[model samples]
Target chain A: MLLILPIIVPMLTAALLLLVRHRGVQRWMAFLGSMTHLGCGIALFRLVQSEGIQVLQSGSWKAPFGIVLVADTLTTLLVIAVGVVGAATTAFGFAGVDPRRESGGYHSLFMVLLMGVSGAFLTGDLFNLYVWFEVMLVASFVLMALHRTKEQVRAAFTYVTLNLLASAILLTALGLLYGQSGTLNMADLSRQWSTAGPPPLHLPLALLFLTAFGIKAALFPWFFWLPASYHTPPAAISAIFAGLLTKVGVYSMIRVFTLLFQRVSPGIYTLILVLSAVTMVVGVTCALTQRDFRRVLSFNLVGHIGYTTLGLGLLSPVALAGSLLYVLHHIVAITNLYLVGGIFLRVRRTTDFASLGSLYRTHPYVALLSLVPIFALAGVPPLSGFIAKIVLVQASFAQGVYWAGGIALFVGLLSVLSMARLWDESFWKDAPDGVDKASPTWKQLLPIGALTLLSLGISVGAEPLLDMTSRVAGDLLEPSAYVRAVLDGDG
Target chain B: MELLFALTAGVLYASGLYLMLRRRLAQLIIGLGLLTNGTNILIFTSGGLTRTNAPVLAADALETTEPFADPVPQALILTAIVIGFGVLAFSLVLAHQVHRSSGTDDVGDRQ
Candidate 1:
């Protein structure tokens, strides 16, 4: 019951806050709800570590008949990540969005989006996952369009259309899976998949599922919608979207590929490997040409997602662990950088690198803050990002995938160069004329500060986190434990 | 019967894909509708067809039964139908809003 509360509380709060008329009250309520949710997530993490996996069967119905919210080690970590990021984004939202420009609807829609994201991370049923995805999409649509600027409206249309198409594909896939397997319960599907011989629909079913999640994860060909649409939104929303949303796609990819699909056919893994390499190279090359700070970061995000997919493509335990840890590290680091960029935009009044300069002189603390995560993103030593990349490269080498490892290392070097470009162009040069001298308020600084502190914490605590990630990878690779827990409802 | 359902699904999918590729919003809506119908039929056929019997048990029925239509897929498709309807309605409203705001029905023009 307690395992489910982190998801439930936010949803209830989101619904409750929608009824409140006052903007200030709504903000505070959302902040409080997010904090409580984070607290619960931490508690849930501890509880899972102390006990084992926590399974809460909704409505007390049996596993196949009712929805279940299961919390394993990986889920516990992801829940905490979602909670922390959700809370930070909410606080950042309060500081960044002007309630006068947009109604209190921003806060409300944000809460709803938070609820939907948390729900998607927590649910254990396939159809229920679709429901949560829709919840997230609806909230995201409203949030993306809240300002209703011409650019935003146009961007939102593309975003909505692509996601809706993905959702349609997802539905078709689900229908096909249910038709063949007669169960939408994830645990049951895994069981049925293992024992059942190759059905007539196996290849098509896999392709359908792959295509649906491929769009969300923004892998090679499907990723164009992302860089095009992301830059049109406000900085705060874009930061959160950049940090978390695509990772949800990556999460689904990891979940489905490992737990559901179980084994990637040799040919498919080759294709995936090729896609991962292309995604990495193409994304960075795109970033190299971008002059806008946000656009550059957005393209960089696409490249980083490839590192995660590459780890999975390697199929080594260490590589998979590295991928999971990289997802966690990237989420924190990228969110920090994006939020810091938001502050820069606030001060400089533009995101174009040509139009902005010399932030280190006036806002030394902000500059330093931005520099830490940017270095980490470059895979500089003593940061969690370095440890994650080291593990991935070592894993790939151990598997004799030297080409993949070499490309990954080269990509890491390119990332460093890209971040250096952002630093040299934005913070190191002379200040632009007529720029505002206003400092970031504590409200704006708080979220970035909290996120930066988290990145440093990851740096300091890299060993323990790595150990946990390895254990999670081991469990994921041998998924009988997960299947048993979901099926038998035991720890 | 299975062939009929399969053909219906194929036609719906073909037309749906064509409509979806069109630049106009109305065609997109029509495409989505057709796509969903195709999906529903696919779901129906994937569950193996039965002669005439449904999977419901009556009070006066015997314990033994044969040749019943698979109830599971029907239940699953029912749920899919409701969800599909929700998505359609949402998309319609979304398209309408985009049309109203942009004063254009063509996706290409809006872009």
Candidate 2:
């Protein structure tokens, strides 16, 4: 029962939002629903922390037969992050989004998007994950095109087409897996693979999974759709997308690689190591050339995705823990950055760096607030990204993958350069003659402040979070406990 | 019979990929349809083909005898079709809107 509530609450909220026509009421209800979602996520996280992995077989049909919702440490942590980001996005949307767009089922679609994300995080069945991906995809498609501007329509076209292709590829992978293993349950497949060694077709199937999830995660070569579309939506929509969407892909990759593949192919991990290095360098490099605030952030988002995968590539307990920590840090910092981008967009009527300036002179507090996430993203000390990056670098060095560790350090330097450039252009320069320098309303600042504090909380509480992630990483590295819980352990 | 189904699926996949590469929105959407259909058939054939035996069990028997079609792929295909339909409907509407807004169906020229 507790396993399904994170998904169910949003599902119900979306339905209720659709029924109500009043925009104001719908917004309030969505906020309430998201808060409730955050509460449920915390409760679920606590339960899992105290009492091992929690598994609920849907309708009591038994595992390897019925669909299951499993909440291990990794899943619960992401759920809590999703809950936090969702609540912040909704709060920001209230003041950030246009009234007309808000009336166009914004709240409803937002809830559905949350539901889909939660479902993706919680599902234990492969096909069920695909369904949740579709649910999220559909809602995101409508939300991106809600304004229906020409640029938006064009961007949505590219986004939708590419994502649908990824989905088809994912389905093909699922079909092949089921045909090869005679089962779609993740634990069952893992058990079979471990007992008999991987099948002859394992390499192709692994590559297929890599391509499908890699595209979603916005890895090096397949990340074009993300930057092309992410900046086109309202900042609130893009913030949520920035916060949670690609991370879901990383989560799936982690889940599939750690749980199902389990070091069967050293070749795959080496390949991932190479890809992640390129991803990190390429993402930050591209971010440097972008003049649009959100576009710069979008490209950086792609680069940071590489860091999460870096841990998975190493496949050590410390590395996996570092990856999880990176994910948690990235979600808060990136989403807050985009929310600040929204405030900038509202003030300047444009996000282009060339046309916007002097925010520091007019709104020192806003600039100060924005600096936290910006520098945090750059891996400055005493922030969440710093600790996460340090762990990954330490793990890579310990494993003697010196080249990859070197690349990680190199990318961290590039990230600092790019973020500092963004600060210099957007906040410190003289204001263009026609642009507005009016301060954002207090409501707009509230969510940003909350997220900034949350990022700070991650920094201050780094030791405990790192400890939890290491434990989670331990469970990921050894899935016997997870498999047993799913197959035989009580809900 | 299995060979024929596999060939059909391969053909669908080939045509789908070909059409999806075109610049036109209509062809792209049609290509998406073919791609999804190709996936469905691949799933069907991969599950092993059965010409005569349905998945239905006899009234007196506790389990069906050998040579029956696998019900799992059929169920998976059903779910795939429904989801494909929803995505298809959405893409079609979005394409129409893209056309109306841009006054062009060529995606390459839209940017």
CAPRI tier of model 1: acceptable
Error of 2 at B34 (Å): 0.8
- Give all candidates' CA lDDT scores: 0.81, 0.91
Question: How much does candidate 1 score in TM-score?
Answer: 0.94
Q: Report residue A467 deviation for candidate 1 (angstroms).
A: 0.6
Q: Which tens-of-lDDT digit does each residue in B1-111 have in candidate 2?
A: 888988998999999999999999999999999999999998888888787677788989888878888899999999999999999999999999999998999989855
lDDT of 2 by residue, A1-491 (tens): 78899999999999999899877788789999999999999999999988978999899989999998999989999999999999998988678467667878889999999999999999999999999999999999999988888999899999999999999999998888888788899998889889988877888988999999999999989999999999988889999999999998999999999878776877898888899999999999999999999999999999999999999999999998998999999999999999998888788878899877788887888998998999999999989999999999999999999998999999999999999999988999886663685669888899999999999999999999999999989989999898999997853
Off by over 4 Å in 1: A100-104, A432-434, B60-66, B100-103, B109-111
User: lDDT of model 1 at residue A294?
Assistant: 85
Give the range of the ten consecutive residues with the poorest summed lDDT in model 2 chain B: B47-56
CAPRI-style class, candidate 2: high
Runs with alpha carbons beyond 4 Å of true place in candidate 2: none
